[model samples]
Target chain A: MLRAAVEAGADAVYCGFQNATNARNFAGLNFTPKELQDGVAYAHTRGTKVLLALNSFASEGRFELWKHAAECGADCGVDAFIVADIGVASHLANQLPQQRLHLSVQAAASNPEAINFYCREFGIARAVLPRLLTITEIRNLKNEVDCEIETFVFGNHGLMVEGRCSLTNYAVGVSTNMDGACSPASHVRYERDATGGMTANLGDHVIDCFAPCDQAGYPTICKGRYRTPVREEPYYAFEEPVSINLMDMLPELIGAGVDAFKIEGRQRSRTYAGQVVGAFRKAIDAILAGQSPNPIDLIGLTEGHKQTQGAFLTKKWR
Target chain B: MSITPLAKLTLGPILFHWDAAAKCDFYARIADECPIDTVYIGEVVCSKRTPFFERHLPEVIERLERGGKTVVLSTLAEVVLPRERKMTTELCAQSDYLVEVNNGAGLGPIAGRPHRIGPTLNVYNVQSMVHLASRGADHFTLPAEIPGNVAALIGAAARPIGVGIEVQVFGRAPLALSARCFHARAHGRSKDDCRFVCEADPDGLQLSTLSGGPFLAINGIQTLSWGYVNLGAELDAMCAAGICYFRLMPHRTDMVTVAKIFFDRLAGLSSPDEAGACLSALGLGPFENGFWHGRAGHLYHTEPEH
Candidate 1:
């Protein structure tokens, strides 16, 4: 899957170590140390680059573990380190000056000053932008900053605060920024209710209950239904389950100074990864070749069978 | 015996919707009774909630100042509109009080001037801390999601620069902020037409999952934990790590008592267990300090007495 991504069109294929140091710290997924070395060799052979994700914040004495992962990544001949913690990024940049550094989306570098600071101090080559910026904002930021920009082209639309979020930890005690998993499956439980509907619970909180006819997505804190005083009726308080598909807006984003397009879901099946990556690879090539890109309907792969351009459209309602 | 405890207590900006008069009265009471050394006053969660208290802010600040408390003005957590930016810039221009930069846009105007970096800025490590300090930040409220070990490292690195460290001690943990208003959406309105719906729930609304279990709370665009975080027991450890301030987020009921409980713990007049018990009695909901202890943030792990 990742090989196809590199072969088809991705400038860098970002994955994480099989540890809690990265945000997608899931079970039976992510690359082991040995697998990471092998993956890097494989990607390099195909003229592709591999970026290691050590994006989660490191605790006090546990800094050595995250630092060790970066050192190990460099030793394995990885292309660059995708980092969130300023401490970890500084450490790796200082320890291995020749190795490239890319700011993780978790860093949430939404402005030029913040991006410039990372570029000036850490020599960051590129920054994966947060999902909150508009196209105009992205264009302005690209002009103001020196580093290349990568934006999410397809995947979960996180309308989140970025970097300061503690929703998952507050529920089940692990956070994407800290422990690398939001609403981890270990703490999540599903059960059948008296109404014969299945209820999804993250820790002690019942996130959602679905009828027999409904399709259930992963149990996450943000994508849950809840009642508030304003409505006095249950509705998605934070956001609905919507996936972002900007395949149609590729030209606009590319024209807006986007250097790369990121496809989310490192935990997805390799088959799904290869399919999406190959499609995007061909799409980008078509755009470059002055041909209309073929329509790629990824509805089956979407989280809720709904798609949005997210903040890019600038529709005040979101 | 030494009289003074190691650190000071800061009252975090009111995150809930209190009627303008009630909001002013709350701060007035804090000035009269609470032993807090600093008080932050501003609308951080929603901009629509700001106008309600705008007229009374001057009086509230004066009363807090009269009570010998160092008052600071805080910026909004998420600033997307041009009008919001203008308001924040005007607030930052006031050199009378310290400005806590909650967003990066707020930080740019106050660069090279002494200010505070709020928890929303994501100060996770020594490098970010140093970077902010170099840009004129003398104090920082570390993100609430950080584990104790990470807090300790930041504390150690910040010591040389004399930058004060503050941590959220009580009230619902603010999980995330967004530009979109969930409250408005719930009421079938856009963010601009919110119509002040948040005013009904002074402490925000409790959100239960489908099975009627406490899940999370929604206050405008901010999502918070169902449990109130009580770090009274961890005060000693945090003090040892060189933390200079402990923040207590305002709630709807018995805030004076809440402040006193924290003050007593800081002053060595009471123990953490006693404070925790007091918190339970007040019905602020279940309390958890797991994140501080480097465990699951929602789980309570009782510590052995030293």
Candidate 2:
């Protein structure tokens, strides 16, 4: 996939080590220490940079693990470490001052003041902005802060506050901020009722239900269907399972001072990532070449065959 | 006689919006009647709602100060706009007042200056706590879902500077925040023209699952626990664990009486049993302290699961 991304015109590719060191802590994904070394070698040989994600919040006895991951990642010749925890950032800034650091979107640094603090404290060169900021806000943030700004342009338009949410912690007994897994598969259950309706659950809590004719969405816990009197039909109580597609607003994003674009779903299969990566690569190239940034068809690739402009295009306050 | 516990009752910043008159009346009552040691005044949840309440702030602060309580201003949890930045910067620059920062975005203005760090800033361990302490924060409200043992560990590291640790002992523990407004989306209203509908739910609008189980509450950009987390049972141990301040997040309840119960219990006037019994009348939701016991945050554990 790294090679595929490279061949498809991706400037950088992010991957995680095969441990609790990253957010996508599924069973079969992520690289081992040896695999990380080889992956970095492969990306570098193909003229691409590899980023190591160490975005989880390090708690009481778990600080050493994050520190070790950084050392090992550096040893593996990765370009930078994407961090969120204050301790990890402070540690990396002081211990490995020469290494590059990028503030993960999980840091929730939506404003320049937060971005400035990260840059000052951790010596971070870039900050991955949260999925929350609007394009206008992004432009304002870029003017206020000195660091490079990256924003999510595709995948999982999460409605819950990332890095601060405990909905998963309240259910699955796993910390999304600390453990890096949101609604881990071990605690998930898909139950089918006699009426041919499917219910998705986190632990014992019912998240969403789908009828026979309805397309079932991923049980992300937050994006679950719910009952509310304000609305007639059973609706997505928090957010619809719509993947973000900013391709329609690429020119505006570029004009809004975005330094780079990010794609979520590192846990997905290689082919899925490569296809999305290729489409986005073409769109970005078209925009940079002073041509029309044509909207590439990506609906079939989306989670629910639906997409949203998300918080970026929406007016914030009424 | 035993030394007074000095366990202060604090009124955390209001995470909801009511009419300015309602807010002013609530604060007037707090100043005149409540036994809260400190009152956090400011709109912490949304920046747009601040204007409606800003005019009442000076008088409210005066009344609270005259009533012999400290008043702290809070910066927004999610800082995105230029106006919000200016507001946070000006608040941080004010030396006459103490500002509680809910995000790292407000840190620059308060850097090397006295301030309070709110729960949303992510102080999980001793290292993170000490790091923030070195940057001039004197007060830390451990995040809503932080377990007791972890708070104790962070508290021990806070001793050198008299950096007092605080915890939410009452009201619905705010679980998360988002840039998107779920409340507006529910009413088929856009965020820009929603007409501040959250004012209707003085506490918060309850959101339940399709199975009819109460789940979360929508408080504008904030997502709160449907269950009001009452820590009356854990107050004794929490106070003993270097937690000096107990914060009651403002909800639509008889806050003054609620303060009295916690105050009485802290002063050894009321039993934990009595305080626990008193909270039932507030008619919030179920009591849950499982987060303190290292279990799922939404569950109330009678005994340690482990």
Interface RMSD of each: 2.5, 2.0
Per-model CA lDDT versus the true structure = 0.81, 0.83
Q: Pick out the ten consecutive residues of candidate 2 chain B with the lowest summed lDDT.
A: B1-10
Task: Give the per-residue lDDT of model 2 (tens digit) for A1-318.
Answer: 666677776789888877776777777878889988998998898888999999888777667888899999989989988988888888888888889999998888887778889888878899998887778878877888878989888888877768989888877668788778888888888889999999888887888888988976678877887777677787876787888888888889999888989887576767777888888888888988989966789888787899988888866422
Candidate 2 per-residue lDDT, tens place, B154-217, comes to 7777766689899998888888888777788788776677789888888888788877888878
DockQ, in order, for the candidates?
0.51, 0.62
RMSD of each: 2.9, 2.1
Residue ranges of candidate 2 with Cα displaced over 4 Å: A1-4, A293-295, A316-318, B1-6, B268-271, B304-306
